[model samples]
Target chain A: MKRLKLFPISRRAKDLLAGKLMLLLTILAALLVLLMVAGLYLKSRPVLASQPLAELLFSTKWRPFRGQFGFFPFIMGTLWVTGVAVLIAVPLCLLTAIYLSEYAPARVREWVKPLIDILAGIPSVVFGVWGMLVVVPFIKDSVAPFFKVFSTGYSILAGGIVLAIMIFPVIIHVALEVFRAVPQEVREASLAVGATRWQTVKHVVLRKALPGVAAAIVLGIARAFGETMAVLMVVGNVAKVPGNVLDPAYPLPALIANNYGEMLSIPLYDSALMLAALILLLVILLFNLLSRAVLARVERSIR
Target chain B: MDRRKVEEGIFRVLMVLATGLILSSLVMILLTVLVKGLPYLSLEMVTQTPRGGYYLGKGGGILNAIIGSLYLAGGATLLAILFSLPVALYLNVYSRPDARFVSVCRLAFDVLNGVPSIVFGAFGFTLMIYFGLRASLLGGIIAIALLILPMLIRAMDEVIRLVPRELMDASYALGATRWETALRVVTRQALPGILTAVLIAFGRGIGDAAAVIFTAGFTDAVPTSLLRPAATLPLAIFFQLGVPVPEVQGRAYASALILTLLILIISVAARRLSRRLTRHVVK
Candidate 1:
C-alpha cells in the first residue's frame, strides 16, 4: 500500500471508480431497454389514443389509403401464420429432440447439434430469398394446385412454412436441453421396470420434460410472431384476414416493415405502424418472459 | 406387449424421419442457394456497383451493398462489443449470482432480445426523427448496436459465468485490484466465449435486415461517410428479389449466397479459434 497515489486518487477510490464505471454501464443498458419501450409507446400515442384499443385490435378492416387503420387483419395474419408454424413445428421438434437426447450416440449428437444451431443462425433475409425463389413457386406449382385451391405463390401457407422451418431449431434446441435434464437414474429405473427404450422416452422423458417443451414451443411461437422479412416476402402483403392457408395475409411486422417508409407522408400511417410495432413488442415480450420463467424453473431442477 | 412393440417401432421410425427432415432443410436451403448462385458468382459480380437498370437484370454487381454491409455490421459489432463487454463483466463480476440488479438486468435483456428487429427499426426511426438524424449509416449502426446489445451481453455473461469464481478470488487475493482481476483473469478464462459472442453478434448484425431497413436507407453507391446512406446485403437481396426479371432474381440468390458464406466463415473461424483459445484456459 506504500505507493504514490495516482493523480490524487487512493486505491479504494480507484476501486470505487471501476465499480462506478460498471454501475453506469449497467444503468445505460437498462435505460436503453426502457427507451425502446417508451419510444414505441410515445411515438404511437396518436393512433393509440384516437381509437378504442378494442376497435384497432378487433376491427376486420384495414385501409391505409382511405384512412381506415384497423389492424385486425395484420393481427390475425400474424396469429394464423404463427399458429400454423407452431402447429407444423412443435411435434417435429419434440421428436427430433427425443432422438438427439435418447437415441443418438454421443458422436452423432455432437455433429448433429451444430447443424441444428447453424440452421438457427441462418439469416432471415437468406430464408426470405429462398422462400421467394423456391417455396412460393413450389406451393403455387404443386402444393396448392394439388389441393385445387386458388393460389398465388405468396400466401399464408408459404409464410407459415418458412416460419415453421425457421422456428424448428429454436424449439428443438430448447427441447434437447429439457430432455437432457431428465435424470439418468429415472431413465434407468424406467428401463429396469421392463419398459422399452422408446417407452421410457415416451412415458417418462416426455412427462418429465413437458413444461420445458412447452416453454420451448412458446419461444418458437414468439419468434414466429416477431419474424418480419421472410414472412413479409412470402405472405403476399395483402391487408386482409386470410380465409385459409392458401390466402394472402399481411402480418404486423410485414405491415410495418413494408410501409413504415412511405408512412411518413400519409396522415396517421406512421402512428398506425408504430402502434402495430408496439403490440408486437408487448406480445413477444410476454411470451418470452413466460418462457424464461419456465426455463428458469427447469434449470433449477436440472442443476 | 406386441402392441407396445409395434408402437415403439413406429415411433422410432417417426423420430428418424422427423430428424432427417429437419436436417435436410438446412442442406436443401444451402444447396438451392449454391446452385442458383454459383453461375452468377463472378469477380465482376462482387467488384462492380449496380449500373443503371441493374434491378432489371442489367449490368454491374452488388459491390456497393457488399462493402456497405461490411461497414455497417462491422461498425455495429465493434460498438456492441465495447458496451456489452462492460455490462457482461459487471453482471458476472460486480454482483452476486442472485442479486436483484443482476436478475432485473437479465430480465430486461430477455425482453429486449424478444422484441422484434423491426420494432428496433421503428424505435430507431422514432429517435432519428426526433434528433433530426437522417437515414444514414450512423443511424443503422446505432440501431443495430441496440438490437444486438442484449444478445452480445447475454452471450458474454454466460461465458464469463462459466469461469470458476475461485480463479477470480485467487487473483484478487494476490493483491490485484478488481479491475485487474476482471481484465486479466476473468477475461482470459472466458476468452473463447467472448470470441464466440463477438462472432455471433457479427453474424447477426450482418444478416439482420429489418432493423436497418428503415434506418440505413438503401443506396446504390458505397458509403463514404457515416452520414451517407448504405446498402446491406439483405436489402440488396430484397430489392433484387422485387425485380420481375429472372436474371435479377438469380442475383438475389447470389447475394444471399454471399451473405450466407460470410456468416459461415465467421462461425467456422470462431469454432476453430475458440477451440485453440481454450488450450490456455484453466477450465
Candidate 2:
C-alpha cells in the first residue's frame, strides 16, 4: 500500500490503461483482414471497374500486354492442382491419423509427432528443389512414359504431388487432434459391445471425428490453394487451361508471383495481379471461416 | 465373423502402409537434399558473398542471403512480438475467453493465418507503392511481420491460457493490480510456452519466401541499412536453380541445404530452450 502511493496514477487507472491498450491491440489485429481486403480491393479497382466481374472470372484469355485479363485459366489451374492434391492427400492423411490415434504404440506415436513437425518445418523452397530434382524427372521419364504419354514433367500432376506432400503435416496434425478429441470412453464402450479395434475406430471414433476431419481437409485445401513457390517450380507456368493432369497450368498465386515484378509497366497489369491476389485472399478467407465454424460446432457437440 | 476379421486385417495393413509412405517421403526429402547438396556445400558457400558469374557456376557464396535472412526474420519476429504479446495477454488476462470480441479476434487470426504468403506479398507490395517505399529490408520486415503476427499471437494465447487461474488470484490477493499479475505472474508461468511461440514465429519468418519475394528485392551485397534490398536463401536457391547450368543448379541444392539446416537448428533449439526454461515455470 505504501509503494502503491508512489505512482502518479491510481492502481485502478494503471490497470485500466493496460487493459485498454491490450484491447486496442486486439481490435487492431482483428481489423487487419478487413484492412488487407480493402487495400487490395482499392488497388484492384482499376481492373474490376474496366471489366465485368463475371467476364474477368470466367474468361480464359490472360493477355496483359493487350490489356485483357481473364482469370478463368488461373482459377481453373488452382482448382485443378488443389483438387489433385486434396484427392491424393485426404485418404493418405486420414489413414495415417487413424493409425497414430487408434493403433500406434506410444513410442511410435512419440517418434512420428516430431517427425511430422520437422516435415512441416521444412522450407517450401526446399520442397520445390526436391520436386524439381526428383518428382519432375521421375514423372518425365517413368510415370508419363508408363502411361504412354509424351510429356514434360512440369504439369498439374507434378504440382499436385508436391503440394500433397507439403500439406501432409497440416492434414495429419489436425486430424490427429480431432481423433484424440474423441473421448476414450466412446472407444471403450464400443470395445465392450464386441466391436473389434478397427471396427470401433471406424464406427465410433471416425463418425465422431467426421466434422473435425472435414475441417482439417478444408484447411489442407486452403493451404494447397495458396501454395506458391513449390507449385511454381514444378507446374510449368504456361497461361492456359489445363485439360488433363499432364498439361501445364498457371495457378493464381503463381500468376501473381511470376509476373508482379516484371510487368508493372504494362497498363492495368499490376491491377490484374492485385485482383488475382484478392481472389486468393477471398477464397482462402471463405475456406478458413468455414473450417473455423465447423470446428466450433465440433467443440460444442463434444462438450 | 471370419470375413470381418479378414477386413480388419486388410485395413490394418492399409493403415500401416499409408503411415510408412508418409514417413518415408519425409526421409526421402531429407536424403535428397543431403545427397545433392553435400558435394557443392563448401565452407566458402557460407562465408563469402557471391562473386562475378556466381550464377554461371564461377565463384562465391550465399553469405549475403544468409545474413540478410537473419536480419529480416529477426527484425520481423521482434516486430511481431511487440504486437503479438499484447493481444495474447489481453485475450487471456484482460478479456473473457468467450466474449464476442475475443471470438472475433480469434477468428481474424485464423483467417489471417490461412491467408497465403503470396497474398501478403501482394498486399505488402501495394502498401509499399502507396508509401513510395522501394523493395528493401524494411519492406520485407513489415510484410513478414504481418504474415507471422497472427501465428505468434495465437500460439502465445494458447500457452498463456494454460496458466492456472489460481496463480493470478494469488497475485491479486497480494494487492497486485491485474497489470502486475499479468506481466509478472501469468507471463512468468507461461514463459516457456512464450519462448516456443516466439521461436516458432522466427522459424516460419525465416523460412518464408513467397511473402518476401516481391517486397525484399534481392541484392548481391549484404544489406547494411533497412532501406537497402536484401537477398534471402530461398530466393537464392530459386535463382540459382533457374540457371540452366549444372553447377548453378548444384549450388541451389547447397543453398536449400543451408536453409533446411537453419530451420532444423531453430526447431531443435526451440525444443531444448523450452525444456530448459520449463524449470522456471510454476507448473
Candidate 3:
C-alpha cells in the first residue's frame, strides 16, 4: 500500500515538473524576439556613434572604400521598389478579395484558395530563378527597346514586379477573410433596401471591412519592405539614385546581403550593416504595431 | 442607371481577369522552370560533389549542397520543434484559450514572424562574433531555427487549439495530471497536426537563402561536424547563377529543380496530413 501511494505521488510530481518546463519553453520563445531587437540596437552603436545621422540619412554615396558610408541611396532603393510593389498589388488584390468572398462559387473558391496557398508556400529562390530566366529576358527583349537607352531589364521595375507577384496571394487571402467576416444580416439589410449587389458591397460591406483591409495592406507593406533574395536577385544591385523605373538601383536588404561576406575588410562596414538591420527591424515593428492597433479596433467593433 | 450598369460590368470583367492572371502566371513559372531544369536532373547531380572549376561550368555534380542543405534544415527543424511543441502545448492544455497571457504570447509570435530573414542573419552574425564562433553548421542551425520558430509555434498552436476540451476533462477525471493528458491524450490527438507543422517549418528553413546566407559559410564538401562551414541548396543556386557561364547557369536550374521538387513534395504532404488530421481526429 505504501509503495502504490509513492508511485502515484511520484508520477504527479513528474507531471507538475513537465507543466513548469512547458512554461519555461514558452517564455524562451518570446525572449527570442526581445533578444533580436536588443542585439541589433546594441551592436549598431559604434557606427551610429561615429557618423552623423544627417549624413547617413541624406547623402547619396555608398562606397565602402575611402571611408564614405552614406545609406540614402539604399533607403531610396527600398522605398522605390516597395512603393511600386504596393501600387501594382493593392488594387488587384482588393478586387480579387471581393470576387472570392462575394461571387466565387463554392467549388471555384475551394480550388482557388488552395492554389493561392501553394503560391504562398513557394520558396523565394524559385521565384528568383523565374525572375532571372523569364521576367528579365522578356523585359530586355520587349520593353528595353522603347526606352531612350538600352536597359538590361535587371532594374527596379523588375524587382517591384516580382515582389508584387510574391506578395499578392498573401495580402488577398487576408482581405478575403475580412470581407467574409462582415455580418450576414448587414448585407441582407442593404439588399432589402433595393440596393444592387455591387452597390451593397461598395457601400456597406466594404465600409465595414475597411479597417481590416487597412491592416492587411500594412502587413503586406511590412512584408515587401524587407523581402530579400527574390528582390535582390533581379534588382541589378547598383549603388545609385535611380533615374527612372528602368534604372538599376540598390536596396537595403540587397546591400546587407551583398556586402555581408566582405564586411571584415572594410572599416565600420559591419557596424553600418548592423545599423541597417536595426532600421529594418524598427520600421517593420512600427508597421506591425499600426496594423495591430487597427485590428484591435476591429475586434472592439465586433464585440 | 446606364452608367452604373457599365461601371459594374467593367469591374466584374477586371476582377475575373485578375484571377486568370494569377492562374496563368503560376502555370507559366512552373512550366518554365520544369522545361529548363528537367533535362539536367540526373542521378549524377545527386551522387557527386562539384569538381575543380565547378562554378566555371565544368563537370561534376551538386551532391554536397544536397547533403549540406538537409543537415542545416534538418537540424533547425529539430531544434524548432523542441521549443514550439512546448509553447503550443502550454497554450492549449495548461492555460485557457482566451487567457490574456496566451494572446500576448500569440502576439509575440506574430511579430517575430514579420521580422525579416536578413535581420535574423544579422542577429546570428552578431552572436557568432561575440562568441568567437566562426560560420559553422551549429551557428546556421540556430539562426534558421530562430527564424522559423514563430512560424512553427503558430502552426502547432492552431493544431493544438483544435484538440477538444472533453478529452482533457476525461483524462483528469481518470486521475491523470495535466501533463499526462497533454503528453499522452492531447499530443496523440494532435500528432498529424504536429507532423504537418514540422513539414512547414522544414520547408521554410530549407528554402530560406537570406537568413542562412551569412551564418552558413560556403563549402564544396558535405558537412560532417556541427562546427564546420556548411553549404545549402539556395546558396548553391545563387553562386552558380553568378558565374556568368551558360553551362553553370544550366546547373543552377537543376539545383533549383531539386529544391522546388523537395518543397512541392513537402507542401503536398502537409496538405494531405492536415486533411487527414481533420477527418481522423476525435472520431
Candidate 4:
C-alpha cells in the first residue's frame, strides 16, 4: 500500500514538472516574439510617425538620404522576381512530385526523393556564390544576348533564375508529401474507370492535392521574397524599378544590407534602415500567416 | 496498344527530365564553385591571414574565418541542445488532453521557424548594441540558437511522440516513475531520432549565414575568445565578392568552395543519420 502510494505521488510530480517546463518554453518563445516587435517599434516609431507610411509605400524614389523613402521600386522588384520564380518553380515542382509519387517505380522513387531533398539543405550563400559566378555569367554571355534590345547583363533575369533554382527543391518536397498523402484507392479507382495515367494525375490527383500544392507555391514565394545573399549577389544591386527583365533593381532586404553599415555611421539613417527592416519583417510575416492558413486548410481537407 | 506505349514513353521522358534538372543544377553549382575556387585553393591560402586587409591577391589563409565559424557554431549548438531537450520532453509528457497550450507551443515554433534569418540578424544587432555586447561571438551564438531552436523542438517533439505507447504502459505497470519512463524507456527508444535532431541542428548552425552576419562582425583575427569579433566563410565570401580585382574575386570563389564543401559533408551526414533513424523505427 505504501509503495503504491509512492508511485502515484512520484508520477504526479513528474507530470507537474513536465507541465511547468512546457509552460516556460511557451512563455519564452512568446516573449521573444514580443521582444522582436518591441525592438522594431522602439527603433522605427519616430520614422513611422514623422513620415506617412502611404508616401513611403507609393514613392518611386528610394533615396533615404534626401528623405525620399518611397518603397515602390523595392516592393515592385521583390514581387516581380518572386513572381517569376514561382512561375518557374510551381509547375516543375508539381510535375516532378506527381511523377515521383504516382508513376515512378518504388526503387526509383527511393533514390530520387533524397537527391531532391539534398538540394533543400544546401546553404543559400553557396547558391549566391554559384549564382554570381556561373548563372550570372551564363545569363550575361548567352541568355541576355537573346533579348536583342537588352545590350548589357547582370539583370533581373539572372536573379530570378537563380532563385527559382533554389526554391524548386522546397516546392518539390512539400508537394511530393501532398501527392503521397492521396490514398492509393483514389488513384486505383480512377485508373479502373479507364482513365489514362496522365488523366488520373491531372484530373483526380491534382484536384485532390490542389490545396497543398497552393500552400507549397505560397511558401516558395515567401522564401523568394525574403532571400538576401543570393539576390544581393546576382541582382546587380541596381536601386531602381526594372523597365524590363534585363533592368537591375534592388529589393527591400538588399536595400537594408547595402546601406546598413553606412547608415549606422549616421544618426537618423540607422532608424531609416530599421524602417526597412520593419517593412521587410511585416511582409514576410503576412505571407507566413497566409501559408500557415493554407496549410491548415490542407490538413482540414485531408481529415 | 501503340498509343498507350507512346504516352507512357512521353511520361517517362518527362519524369527523367524533371529529376535530371534538380541534379543538374546541384552539379552545376558545385562545379562552378570548385572550378573557380580550385586555382586559389592551397594549404597557404587556408593557414595564413590576409596581409592586404581588404585588397586583392595578398590576404593570407582563411584560418580566422574557419575557426570563428567552428567556435560560434559549436557554442550555439551547445546552447540550443540544452534549451531544446527538456522542453521537448515536457511538451510530450505534460499537458492535459484538452490543453490549448500545446497547440500554442506548436504554433509558436512554426512562427519562429518562419521568421526570416535576416530579421533575426537585425534583432540581434539592435539588442546586442543596446545591451553593450558589441559585435561579439555571444551575440552570434544567441542569434543562431534562436534560429536552430525551432527546428530542434519540432524534430524532438516528433520523435518523442513517435515513442510507442506500449512502452509507457508497461513501464507504468511495473511501477517505474514517470520520469524514469521518460528518461530510460521513452528516450532510449527514441535515441536514434533524437540524435538525428541534434546532428541536423548542428549542421544548420554550421551552415547558417544571415542570422550570424550582423551579430558576428567580420574580423580577420582568429577567435580564441568567444567575445572577440570574427569572420565566417560566408561573410568572407560576401566581403571578398565585392573586391574590384579579378584575383581577389577568384579568392572569394575559393572560400565559397571550401564553405560549400563543408556544408555538403555535414548535410550528407545528417541525411544518413536521419535515414538510420527511420530504419530503426521500422525495426
What is the number of backbone collisions in each predicted candidate, taken in the order shown? Answer: 0, 0, 0, 4
Q: Estimate each model's TM-score.
A: 0.97, 0.98, 0.97, 0.93
Model 3 steric clash pairs: none
Poorest 10 consecutive residues by lDDT, candidate 3 chain A: A294-303
How many backbone clashes are present in model 4? Answer: 4
Chain A TM-score across all models, in listed order: 0.95, 0.96, 0.95, 0.90
Ranking of all predicted structures according to DockQ, beginning with the best and ending with the worst: 2, 1, 3, 4
Q: Is the docking of candidate 2 incorrect, acceptable, medium or high quality?
A: high
Fnat, 2 decimals, each candidate = 0.74, 0.85, 0.66, 0.42
Q: Pick the candidate with the highest DockQ.
A: 2
Model 1 misplaced regions, further than 4 Å: A1-9
Evaluate model 1 with DockQ and give the value. Answer: 0.76
Worst 10-residue lDDT window for candidate 4 chain B reads B90-99
Tell me the tens digit of each residue's lDDT in model 2 across B1-283.
Answer: 6877988999999999999999999999999999999999999999999999998888899999999999999999999999999899999889877888888788889889889899999999999999999999999999999999999989998999999988998898998988988898988899898998899889898899999999999999999999999999889999999999999899899899899999999999899999999987786
DockQ of each: 0.76, 0.85, 0.73, 0.51
All candidates in order of TM-score, best leading = 2, 1, 3, 4
Identify the candidate with maximal TM-score: 2
lDDT of each: 0.89, 0.92, 0.87, 0.78
lDDT tens per residue, model 4, A24-107 = 865786467667868976887766776788987778876666766677888888877777778777767776887788878999
Alpha carbon deviation, residue B86, candidate 1 (Å):
0.7
For candidate 3, the per-residue lDDT at A57 reads 76
